[model samples]
Target: MQTEYRYITESLAINDYGSGDRELVSVNDGPGELDELFQRVGFYSASHDFRELCGFIRRFPKIGPYNALLLHIQRPGCTFVATAKEWKTDFNRTVKPGARPLVILRPFGPVNFVFDLQDTDGPDPFPEDLLEPFKIHDRSREAECRYALDRLLNAVPADGIAFYPSDFSTAAAGYIETAGIGSWQKFRGHQLKVHYNHVVSRNLPPVEMFASVLHELGHLYCGHLGTVDKRAWPDRKHITDAGIKEFEAECVSWIVCSRMGIDSESEKYLADYLDQNSRIPDISLEVILKAAGMIETRIKKGIPVPKSMKIS
Candidate 1:
């Protein structure tokens, strides 16, 4: 494959993905949602937290020119200034005029999620020409989370076994592997002991047990919790984003239980959870796909999920 090249600000130190070392290329300019994102967040400065933010984003494939984009999202930023047609026509005219914008919504500060926009999928090729701007939400996502959780918990079987609440902190939710406990291998084997002690208390209703078990199952099945590194996380908490982990797990659990004829309450909780947590009114297809990965086996083959036994 021919490598695409783009120029990043000298300060950001972006990896060169393509062949050329050129500073800028407007080769595939187009009118895409990514362009709209750029118009939303405009121009970076010499010193901004964006440097760190870009550093994080650049690690992923299909992501480039993060520093420049981060610069545009920093404080004292102009919203929709850089991405407007005026700037796109001038700076990004080299690309196709009608590509769908690639949008990534990231959390910023205490209670806001910012949507970072980009045009090209792979390399920026024209990092010099790319512009970014900030768009902030003035609220918390707690409500959405509660709704999603409620929906997930309400949909499971209530008669089987006791369930315990895991003592995982919110911070640990980000980098969790959804695959499951088995994936964590040695690290989880030990950590589960500690978490088990903290969370396991009394016999829980089968449905509740199912919900909690399903939640962890979602973590494992989705490969989220399994990917955690106990030492690397802050305060021994998992390093993954909490909202993403919880929401995805909940989405998976809810849908799966729903398919298995678990109960109406599970559906109610899931509906509520979705209602309260999602920033956008609609659920994304990615969420659906992740959820599907979790519950597909149980629904298809009627596999009995794991459970804790009660002592007489």
Candidate 2:
């Protein structure tokens, strides 16, 4: 019976079979029989800090096996069980005899229970501080990011790009425009003029400005600003499409900014953009990755900008 139970459980786990009417039909035995089978199959013990377990479940709501295991072991009125060591370590409380043990399967170590959680309507078990590190603050590392972006900009050809602070509205953080007006053109071939919102750049943290600059740079380097006739360029209509342009540029920004530990809305922007478009054009992932890599490399090299070409 023990061997048969193990075989059945392992089969269920591997194939993810037995759905709807077939679910738990074969395991219609009493709780004592199921408990004995679980114990035999090495599922008799588990542990976790109450808060930590709650947080883990909350963070990964779709964890199927763990959720199923919890449902299997949890009782309606009885408080949960904890190992003596776990109770001592985390709760500094004693476990009564009537509490049942919750089993957890560890990948590497001995299976053990650290703590048991009882149903409660009280405050959250995990404190805010536990999750604080995961939050992204745009200004927290602005100086480092600014230095990196400045270095990247410095590596580009001096004649090909120019930056200026403008009195644009707050909505416009920064933008890039081609330098030439007509066939005569003001600057050299395909040179770009980047404009940063002066008030926002001065008043807000530099991280937002840095991200905006990188996004515009992404458009320039990723060929979004190039003529449709250019080699490897997307179709003219797709290139001119706002959704496609924003998606590609934001994807570039996300790749580079994430690599540099800078936070941006690029992921959200890309996700929303993609969600709205049913048929996305074949944008080259390799191109985006390569562009991001080149930009990162340039920034990391820390090339010095000439004083005459410096943008204030």
Candidate 3:
């Protein structure tokens, strides 16, 4: 059965993660209020995907539901403080200056975690250059990275998980060390690297970008990266190896995009690649469909292995 989880707080006080000027207030104002507020928030609003909230709930299973409380505030300053239980009795409590309290209430269920949004800052959901992936300086195979990304993330089927879209392509079209520190996609302590170039020409279409993120998420969903040999591929026998790589990524991207009713450029790009590989019978839609079915099952059951499903 689907796990039924909810944010049982009576109200939600949210601000611009850290901006001192807290402007909006979101509460469980019932259906009508939610609808009106959503109309103002638009589709890509921060709260649109309740997956994060679900993560929050799961992380802190100790917090009671109906009995829990929500604290919403306007100015949750740098020193904004929070906790699961009473600070004075159950735990320690100390409010220092320079901090603002946005919301202060007991959660409805057992307490697992309490986050002061100020501490755990995240990326701004909307950025001007978010679509940089579509633009590339090189027209070589690197140009296909975004298209490959789209197929990998959105085309795969996975439950309760998704990949975040990123425009930071690398100069190495095959593999390179990621710069900076503490990046999320790091594998083996290295930032998740791919065989793509950092070229920019145009932003990936919004639907395509979203689909790309989902498609990459599928790679993670199926644990394809963790288990599958980085170099060994099923279609290594084909003359069009690049075509084969794109096909795998695209097949996953198409599956996730189709399942969620998202706009996918899969049909367009896949058709182009397939045309070039007309001699390869294994690169057919029937093969794609077979792979997708296997991916879908892995995502649904939360199986974290490539062996979970056999693509027959």
lDDT of 3 by residue, 12-31 (tens): 32211111011111221123
Cα-based TM-score, every candidate: 0.29, 0.43, 0.28
The CA lDDT of each predicted structure is 0.32, 0.45, 0.32
Task: Please give, for residues 64-162, the per-residue lDDT of candidate 1 as tens digits.
Answer: 222224333342232222233533464453223464222222122111122223422223343432232112322223343334344433322211211
TM-score for candidate 1, residues paired by index: 0.29
Residue ranges of candidate 3 with Cα displaced over 4 Å: 1-206, 214-240, 273-291, 298-312
What is the Cα-based lDDT of residue 223 in candidate 2? Answer: 64
Best by lDDT: 2
lDDT of 3 at 223: 31
The TM-score that candidate 3 achieves is 0.28
lDDT of 2 by residue, 25-120 (tens): 122112223334544643432222221232332332112223223433343222333457755565555555565454333333323343345421
